[model samples]
Target: MHILILPSWYPNHANDIKGVFFRDQAQALAHYGHTIGVIALQRRSLRTLFPKKQNNKAPHFELDEGVPTYRCQVLEALPKIPYGNYFLYKRAAKTLLANYVEENGWPDLIHAHSTLFAGAVASEWGNENNIPVVITEHNSGFALNIYRPWQLKVADKATQGAQACIAVSPSLGEVLDQRLPSSKGRWEWIPNVVAERFNAPASKKYSAGPTRFLNLALMTEKKGQYDLLYGFSKLIGGGTKAELWLAGDGPIRAALQELANQLEVSSQVRFLGQVAPNQVPSLLQQVDAMVVSSHYETFGVVAAEALMAGLPVIATRCGGPECIVAEGDGLLVPPRDPQSLASAMDHIAKNLSEYSPHAIAERSKSRFSGAAVAAQLTYLYTRLLTSNSKVSQPKS
Candidate 1:
């Protein structure tokens, strides 16, 4: 099968982390022996004009890890115009798809990530060309209650037009069902794949040091870093010998640092800003456990990654972690509660022997590895294709 991916956002460069999961999924499908391609449309804001380096008006093509990728960058200069940015995205996507079809012929299926614009673009193109489309939504706007009316309308249309709609977690699926009841029957829960680099042997014994708990996420208000600091203070006050390590940086880093200082836990907390994706596995191995302090998540990816590396996790009942963390894997506490979070952390630190790293890794791999997710996606693709064949043929 030939599958083409359209992501609302994608890595502009090698180190870029935006919509990286879409790229990983495309690679996984390719590894499953299907021909895969990616067409990414990135819109740059006018604020970045001063730092402009090169002309990016033309589409850029490359064979990224054996999968063909086409990228087009556009400047968003008409923010005040209604749907101006979306119009630019549609134009670029249509042009890029035409070029891809000219080179490789029409794909057997179109898989779009997120509904904001990519899913809408793919839905429009598929409907016009008589192609099948599958949209996997990863946006948290619905859960966060931040989607504007126009955005919600676009999401509704895109989901209604797709052959299938997928959510990265059961909670996200439920949210989609509630928001777009018309597409409820088409919804499926599919998780993002954990990168293969996270593989590590299960630790037989805890690392010799102050029990280190790591939190890997952007230092944002929604990530609940402040609550994490307060919880860590409570844990320390309760006489637990532990260290807190925060990986990743964001706009609120200075504020979080200030909170740590005010709480006087700054000495026990370490901020390792913006840890690279390649460094995550080793970081997991170095730490005794991981903590996810987010108020909400579409999918708690870090928790899955930690479990894959044989490290236990203390995740909140935030939307996604409830699905990823199982019994014996770690404890799940209510979100935004410092006392609950502190208690859970303390419990994990004291009962490390009760959580088997080997068992956690085995279960996590079975659910989240590339091979595992690829198999599930292949099954979905085959089923959709077979059903489509019985219905009608594509228009030439």
Candidate 2:
């Protein structure tokens, strides 16, 4: 089967982490013996015009890690005009689709990531061409209630038109079903694939030190980093020997640092700003446990990565983490509750030896590895295709 993917945002460069899961999923499908291609459309603000980057008018094609990819950048010329950016996106997408079909022929199915724009575009094109469309929504906006009225309308149309719609977590699926009741029965949940590097055996042995707990995410209020800091401070006050390592950079870094100082836990908390994606697996090996304190998440991907690296997680009962952190895999606490978080951290520190790294990693592989996700996707694709064929057949 031939599958074409439309991702709302993609890595502009090799190290860009935006929408990387879409790329990984495309590669996984290709590895499963299905032909795969990607069309990534980037909408740049007018400010980028001053830098005078490479030509943005034309689309470019490349073989990205053996998967055919086409990328184009559209400058948002009329920001104040209603629906201006979306019109530009639709125009660029049509041209790219024409070029792709000319070179690679029509695909058996179109898989779109996110519903705001990509899913809308894919649904339009697929309907016109008589092709089945599958939309996998990875946006946190639905959970955050942040989408504009117009944006929600677009999402609804896309969801209603698609043959199938998927959410990255079950909790997210429930939210979409309630918000977009017309598409309720079509929604399904699937976990994202963990990178193979994370699945590799631990390369470094854990050295004896103060039990280190890692929190890897952008330093933001919604991420609940402040809550993590408060919890860590409480753990110290209770006479626990532990160090909190916070990774990733954001606009609130200085604010978080100030709070740590105010709480008098500055020395115990280390801010490792913006660790690269390739370094994450090794970092996981060095830490004793991982902590996710987000208020809400479409899917807590970092938690899955830590589990794949054989590290236990202490996650809040935020929407996504509740699905990932199973019994004995880790402990789940209520989100934004510093006392509960501190208690869970202390428990993990005391019973660190009880958590089996090998068993944790093995369980993660069965659910999140590339092969595992690919098989599930292939089954969905075949079923959709078979159903489409019967519906399109003429009366015998």
Candidate 3:
């Protein structure tokens, strides 16, 4: 089986961290003996200043993590186009597809990660070629109520034309059902793939200082970093000797840091911006626990990773974390509630010895591993293949 994955977010030279999970998933699916290729439509507008070194490159084609990938640049270096941009993107995608088909032939299936422009492009192409398209949505923007109307409209069309819709978590599926009723029946659940490297149970090391709680996210408002700050401050006020390490970089980093300063938790919080994906395991092993305070998540990949690291996660009642963080593995609190989050943080600080790292890692194997997810995805793709066969053949 051959698959062409169109991820809305994909790691690139400029943004190496973007959609790394999608690449991980592609590799995981490839592990099951399925040939996988990926492509992403990345547009550069005036808001982003491209590096001078990559100015000459166009139609960037390379093997991303051993999987053949093509990142076709849409309209770049253009002044205020003031448009939907998908029109330009779709045109570029169509042209890229022609080149892609000429080289690798038509893929057995086209899978889109997130229902933004990628799903839309795949849906349009699928309709034209009589191919089966599957969309696996992972963006939290929809559930967080920050997505635009145009984005939703495109996703809706993608869902309508899709053979199936997949959500990383049941909670995300529910959100999609509410937003697009047409896909309610077609929705399926498959979790994100976490590397086996992190599956080693952490040896919880107690340093001669504050207990460390690691929060790995984009540091955005939707991620509820402020809530984590307030919660950590509460723990500090309660005389809990613990510190919070805020990882990842985003637009909210400065504001979050300022908030931390204002809340007097600046001394207890360490802002570690943009840790590489490969380094997560070591960081998780060092930290006593993980905190995910996001308002919503399509799937809390980090929470799953934390479990893989044998670290208990204290996540919010956000969409995906509820599905990922099980009882005894971690604690769940109300989203955006600092009091609740602080209480949970303090509880973990005092009762750190109660959680078994090895048990956490062992239990997470079936649900979050790359191979585990690949098996489920393979079965789904096989069903889609069968469906395609039924459609291609005569009614007799």
Two-way lDDT contest, 1 vs 2, winner: 1
What does candidate 2's lDDT look like per residue over 219-238, in tens digits? 88999998999999999999
Top candidate when judged by lDDT against the true structure: 1
Q: Please give the TM-score that candidate 2 achieves against the real structure.
A: 0.94
Model 2, CA-based lDDT: 0.87
Q: TM-score for model 1?
A: 0.95
Q: Which tens-of-lDDT digit does each residue in 1-396 have in candidate 3?
A: 988888876777533667878878888888878889888777777555546566535347987567888877666453344325777877888887777777887888889987777888898788777678889988777777776666677778889988889999998888888887668767899888997767764455545568899999987788998888988888899899998999999999999989988998888889999988878888887788999998878788999999988888999988888888888997999999999988998888888888888888877888888889899888988898886753352111
**Model-by-model lDDT, in order?**
0.87, 0.87, 0.82
Mind giving the per-residue lDDT tens digits that candidate 1 earns over 109-145? 8999998899999998988887889999898989888
Candidate 2 regions off by >4 Å?
A: 52-59, 200-206, 390-396
Error of 3 at 29 (Å): 1.0
- Those runs of model 3 whose alpha carbons end farther than 4 Å from true positions after fitting are 49-59, 76-83, 147-150, 201-208, 390-396
- How many clashes show up in model 2? 0
